[model samples]
Target: MQLEEIKETCPFCWSCIWLLVDPSFDQIYTEDCSVCCRPILVKTTISDNQITLTLAQEDDGF
Candidate 1:
C-alpha cells in the first residue's frame, strides 16, 4: 500500500494545506503555513495498507 495523499487541516493553526506523499512513502511534502509562512514537518508511515500521518512543529527537532 502507499500513502497517496493527505487531506487534513494544519493542526498548528487550523489552516488548510495539502500534504502529498511521494511514491516511495519515505517522504511527505506540503506548502508552507498560510498563517505563519513557516515550514511544516510531516511524518508518515504505511502499514497494512493504511497510512498514518503526523504533523509536528518544524523547529521541534525531529
Candidate 2:
C-alpha cells in the first residue's frame, strides 16, 4: 500500500488537516475531525496513479 499525505480542510470547522491515503484502491470511510470532533465521510478514488479525495459530513447523502 502506497501511502500519501494530503492537505485538506475540515468540512465542519474548516481547519487545515493532513490525511493519509492509499493510492492502491478506492475506499470510503468515516473519521472525526481533530478540531471539532465531528464525524466526516472520506472517499478516495484511485486512477492512473492519481488519487482523488472527497470529504463530507458523515450523515450527508442519506
Evaluated with TM-score, which candidate comes out highest?
A: 2
- 1-62, model 2: which lDDT tens digit per residue? 56899988999999998888888889999888888899889999988888888999988832
Task: Provide the overall lDDT of each model, using Cα atoms, as 2-decimal numbers.
Answer: 0.67, 0.87
Q: Backbone clash tally for model 1?
A: 0
What's the residue-level lDDT of 48 in candidate 1?
A: 71
Clashing pairs in 1: none
Please provide, for model 1 over 17-62, each residue's C-alpha lDDT reduced to its tens digit, 9 standing for 90 to 100: 7666654565555457667677777777767757777777777735
Q: Give the TM-score comparing model 2 with the true structure, all chains together.
A: 0.89
Give the TM-score of each candidate: 0.64, 0.89
**CA RMSD (A), model 1:** 3.3
